[model samples]
Target: METITFHSYRGGVGKTVLSVNTAVQLALLGKKVCLVDFDLRAPSHQSLFISSTFSMSPTAKSFTGFLVGDHEPQSVINSTDKENFYCVFSDIEIFQQKESKVRTKLTQHGEGRILAKLFEFVRYCNTQKFDFLIFDCMPGVTYRSLDALIVSDKIMVVTRPVKSEISGLRLVISECYSKLEGAEIFSIMNQVENIKDLVHPPNPLDVNFAKVNVLGITKCLEESSVPIPLLHSFPRVPFVTERIYVLDEKNHPFTVEIETFCNKLLQK
Candidate 1:
């Protein structure tokens, strides 16, 4: 199984939105894909799918339970309403509580236990025969976040056009390179208005510092590039607020392009 993790140095950079959409698109193409909500502190992937009607289930159990020895990792694998996509929801509240308790325990014991639990979870996912395992990681460099990076085969750093976002991307890339030797790292620019319009076009400056593999650009369908590119871009679309019937893949621009991207990835 190939594990792809989406991460960012800071929040409010549309990591969850991109990760969920990417997973949905891949699933629509009939690939067995699992979207793991590893963002324990601020869990929102489940919210994106069910919105206000979020409920805990056998598959949607909290990661905290696994971390604290309350439950096995398999207990947290919850199937989403979507056909081919499943989610492992994070229990943000429980994570925060346990994080506070960490101080009481020996530092290495607390940290090591969490790392071991996460690796065990990854080994379980490998056994499940998933074609693609997408991890929506938490923002910033936390022990939990680093654990995700260590386990992943490929790391895709998502960022916006803002200067602060770029700076954060640099830090994230640097940290990932330092720990994950010889891991494939790619950069994707999300929510891009116009590639040419930006005052300073993003070049390969500090990218080499982290030894990043540059993926092609993704723009809106109207503004999309000719011959397409490796990176899949989408126009700013209306948020799917409430539960609605899934649209046909051909009809939805975002879904169609994303599905195409997944096919291309498989070919590679």
Candidate 2:
């Protein structure tokens, strides 16, 4: 299994959106994919696939459930309408109920069982042998995020054109890359106005890191008032407010960017 972790330095850069949508795009291509939401701050991946899925219940068997021994590690995996795509989301109840405990597990570093449980969860994911295991990581430099970086075979630092976010991504590369031996690093520039403008010289953020692949740019999502439908056939691109881009429509212009991104991953 190829383990990919999606991360961002700051919040509100659409990290979870990119992670979930990428999983959907891969599933659309008929590949077996699993998305695990490690965004303990506010896990929301379950809402995206819960309605139409006939798989495991995020509320019944969540990451917290597994950690607290309420559920088995393998039993929490939930499937979606997309045949082979699956996800493991933290139960909102458990997360809120065990906030302090969860925080302790994630922040206590080496002197805790949370990290060990996390690796055990990683082992379960690897054991499944899914073609891809996408980790929807939380923002900032928490120990949990660092742990995700450690486990990832490849890391995609989701950044925007903003200076602070770019600098944060750079810091992540400078510090984390050395620790992650043999792991490929990617800078997936999100919320770009123009992909072409970025490719030319004097690129945004200057692109000096050799291991960091500028895996093209993904366009900003559009906001909408209409509730986006649960995707069955993807014919339209996604809207920022809804999972519409590649999940709702396949022929949308955004689909090309997703195709290119996933293809680049496959190539690596």
- Identify the candidate with maximal TM-score: 2
Instruction: Give the clash total for candidate 2.
Output: 10
- Model 1, 110-223: lDDT tens digits are 647777877788788889877788989888887778877878887776666555554565566456545675456665565544334345755656444322322222222113
Once model 1 is optimally superposed onto the true structure by TM-score, how far is the C-alpha of residue 198 displaced, in angstroms?
15
Question: Candidate 1: where is the Cα deviation over 4 Å?
Answer: 52-59, 81-83, 95-99, 102-111, 194-250
lDDT of 2 by residue, 1-268 (tens): 8888888778877777677778878888888898888887788776766543334454436775676556778788876556887888775664455556654554557564666676787788778878888889888777778778877878776766554554565556555554567666665666654434444555545444211322211111111121111111112233555353676666766666677777666777
Candidate 1 residue 192 C-alpha distance from true site, Å? 0.7
| Alpha-carbon TM-score of each model against the true structure | 0.74, 0.75
Q: How large is the C-alpha RMSD of every model relative to the true structure?
A: 8.0, 9.8
What is candidate 1's CA lDDT for residue 205? 67
Model 1 whole-model lDDT (C-alpha atoms): 0.63
* Residue 137 shift from truth in candidate 2, angstroms: 0.2
Each prediction's whole-model lDDT (CA): 0.63, 0.65
